[model samples]
Target: MNETKEMRLAAINNLIKFISERGRRFFYRERNRMTGEPQTAYLKLKNNRIYFVDAYTSKEVYAYSGYPHDGFSHGGTLWALVCDFSIFVRTGKSSNGKHGYGGLYSGDWGHGDEIQEEIINYAKEIGYLE
Candidate 1:
């Protein structure tokens, strides 16, 4: 199955709605600061933009920032991910053949249930319907 523009928009809208409805009041994560432990508030999305309420204590982190490659490479990385998933049933990796999410996926970070489910549901709803 392939995703249409409408399907992609729907998925994006669903993700936004899910986050808006059940994101968090004040989510926190452990951080390191000099000698004492610090608690960093989770990032927030407002009007489709990300913000940090507790900016001084928070750090920007990407789970796959250094996975198989540096994510910052300017080769349309996210578009490639979307294209491979939207068009093909597999990434040609025999070890994990036919799993919807393909080669470039990193394991989920332990943020909790809501975001994880939101990701999976959006994927399926957008035509990765495995």
Candidate 2:
């Protein structure tokens, strides 16, 4: 792989590690209410930032800086850490309907499709995703 690809993979691996170490797995009741089935999500914390991931779909991954949270569950902190790392995977522009990119307004926004696929594939390879 080229330097860029290697760097991307490294970043992805780091994020996965982060989440695996400091993430939480929760049945998102709000989403589950609508979907009918349990919608599993992973949440992580870092300083004042919060990272969220749809564990099943691996499609919803983003970070929220300055997020207000009283506390977090003790379970699955590792997974939460990995999800928190998702922020680096896709930095988005400040738009009305775009994914929140660390609460930033301007950046490369990363490669959404490629990164998403890589995340999904990597998660499966490591048994994070079934």
Candidate with the greatest lDDT versus the true structure:
2
Candidate 2 lDDT score at position 90: 34
Per residue, candidate 2 scores C-alpha lDDT tens digits across 1-130 of 2233234335455434433333231233324433566544554433434455454443433344333222322233323333334443333111221333331112232335555455455644433343
Q: 7-125 in candidate 1: lDDT tens per residue?
A: 44344344334433443412222343422454433223345433223312344322122222232221233323333432332221122222334433334323367665765566455
> Best candidate, TM-score-wise?
1
The 0-to-1 C-alpha lDDT of every candidate, in the order given, reads: 0.36, 0.38
Tell me each candidate's TM-score: 0.28, 0.26
Candidate 1: C-alpha lDDT: 0.36
